[model samples]
Target: MGLEKFGKCLSMAAWMSLLVVYAYAEGSSRKWRNEVLKQVNSKGPYIGLITVFPPEETAFFGTGAFKPSPIHSSLDLSGRRFRIGKVHDKKVIYVRCGVGMVNAAAATQQMVDLFEIVGIIHFGIAGNINASMSIGDITIPKQFAHTGIWDWVNQNGTLDSNDTVAHLDFETYNVPKGGHNILGQIRYIHEEFFSVSGEPNIARPLFWLEVNQEWLHVATKLERMELEQCINKSLCLPKKPKLVVGLRGTTANIFVDNAAYRDFLFHSFHVASTDMESAAVVMTSVSNGIPVIVIRGLSDKAGGQSGQNAIKTFGPLAARNAAKAVLQFLKQLN
Candidate 1:
C-alpha cells in the first residue's frame, strides 16, 4: 500500500477511538441518548419535556439563531430513544422558552416535534395576592387570569361581565392522552418585605391543556389530596416552597409595575404569587402535547431594582431548585 494510504487509515482509526472515549467521560449524561437498547426496560418509558424562563430573566424560543427540529426520529412518543441515557430512565430535556405567550408556544412545538414527552409543568415565581401569601409558598394554580384579556376584577367584589381576558383557566383546559399530572397547583416564593410600606408581591402559577389526550390518567387520585394538604399546612411554616398545591392564580401580561396594578391583581384574582413566564409555558406545552411544569422564585416587588440586581440575588437559586424538582418528579414517575 502507498505510504499516504496507510497514514490516512491510521488517522481514521485514531479519530474513531477519540469519539468513543468522549462519549463515556465524566458527567456524560448531560445530553440525551446513550448506548442503544431495544426491548423496553422494566422501568417506565421516557418523558421528554421543556421549561420556560424558569427563575432567570433570560429569554429563548424566539432567537432565529437556533430553531428546533420537527422531532428527533430516534425517540418514541414517551421521549425514549433506542439507545439513549446511561440508565434507560425517562429521558428529559429543557428549553428556555422565553417570556410571554408567543415564545412559549414556539418552544412547545419544537419539543413536540423532537420527542415524545408525556407531561409538562410550567414552574416559576409570582407576585402576592390579598396579603395572605408570604414568601416561599408553593401554589398550584387551578386558573390563570390575564388582566390584559379583561378588566381587573376588584377586591371590592363588583362582578363586571365586560372583562376581556388574555388569561385562561388552567384547571378547565383539556390535557392529552396522559393528561398532565395533577396540574392544579403552582409552587411559589414570596418576595421579602423591605420597608413599612413595601409593595405587595404577586405570585401565581402556569396554566395549560393537553394536545393529544384530554386528561393525564397517571396522576394518582391521592396526588390532589396530598398537594392540598401541603399548602394548607405550609402557611404556619417558615420555609421556601411551603408545599401548598391547589388552585393557584395566573396572569397574562407583566403586572409587576405599579402599586395600584399590583394591588388590583391581588384583590381581583386572589393570587399569592406572580411572575412573567409560566402562563406562556403552560399554554404552549399543552398545545404541543408536551407536559411541562414551571417553578418560579420571587425576585423583587415591581419597582424594587434593576433587572440585573433581581437576577443576581435569586436567579441561580431558583434555577437550581427548579432543576432539582424536575429531576425528583422524573424519578417518581419512573
Candidate 2:
C-alpha cells in the first residue's frame, strides 16, 4: 500500500475505535440513570410534597382528617428530612422546605437529587396582591417568577429612559439620600438557568418558570371542587373562597408588608399571589426538568390593606385550605 493509504487506514481505524468507546460510555451512563429511576419507582412513583413552614405542613400532618404519615425520614446529608409514606394510597415524600428562597430552592434540589421524585407539589400560604381576590381564596399560579433578582441602577444610569427595563424607583419610599439601604432605582432582571442541552443557551434568561401544562389542565377539575369558606363558626370570610388558576405569582426573599411594593408587583406582573418560597421551589424543580405546581391560599392582602397584615389572624386557616386543595390536586394528579 502507498504511504498515504496506510496513514488513511490507521486514521479510520482510530476513529472507529473512538466511536465504539463513546457509544459504550453513553449507553452505560444512560443505563445507570435508568436503573436509579427504576429502583426508586419499584413500588410506585413517589411524589414530592413540599411545604414552607410549620403552619403550611400542620394542615397535612397536624390536622384531623390528615394524620401524620408513617414517615421514613431520609436526606440527612443536608440536615433536612424527607418523609416517605402513603397518602390516599399514593406514594409521597413530604418535606418542609423552610421559610425563604434559599431554603426552598436547596430543599427542592435535595429532594430531586436524593430520591427520584416523579413530580413536585409545593403548597403554602401567600399574600394576595390581586385586588379582586380575597382572603381564604386559593391561587394555583400557572408560573412563578423570582422577582427578587434585581440590578440597583444609579439615577444617572440609562435605565431612566429605558422603557424595556422594568425598573422600580425608590423615590416613593422617601428614605432620603443618606438613609439605610437607600437606593436610587432598581431594575428587574431575569434569572439565568442552566440548560440540559449541550448547545449554548446563554441568551435565555428565564423570568417565569411554568408548571406542567397537562398537570395544570388536570387542575381544572379542582375549580368546581368546593372549598371551605370559613375555618370556624365565627370566622367566616366576606365571600366564599374561590379557586383562581392560570394566574401569575411572584416570589422574593423579602417578606412583603408594604402596599406600594405589593401594588408594584400587581401592576407590573399582574401577579395574583406573592410569597417568599414558591418561586424558588418552582425554579429548582423546573431547572431539574421535574414537573412542579404551586398551591397557595391567600392569608392576607400583600400589604394592600390599611391595617396590620391579615396573615396573623388567617394564616392557619389559609394553610389548611391550601392543604385541602393539595389533597384534591393529588387525587386528580393520577
Best by TM-score: 2
Tens digit of per-residue lDDT, candidate 2, span 141-260: 998888888878765565634323377877666656544334678888888777554245554667888987888888888987677777689888888888888998999998888888
* Candidate 1, run of 10 with poorest lDDT: 221-230
lDDT of 1 by residue, 78-120 (tens): 3322222311244534455566666665666655554344656
Point out where model 2 deviates above 4 Å. 1-44, 63-75, 160-165, 172-182, 197-203
Report, for all candidates in order, the number of backbone clashes: 71, 0
Error of 1 at 265 (Å): 0.7
- What's the C-alpha lDDT at position 111 in model 2? 83
What is the lDDT of every predicted structure here? 0.43, 0.81
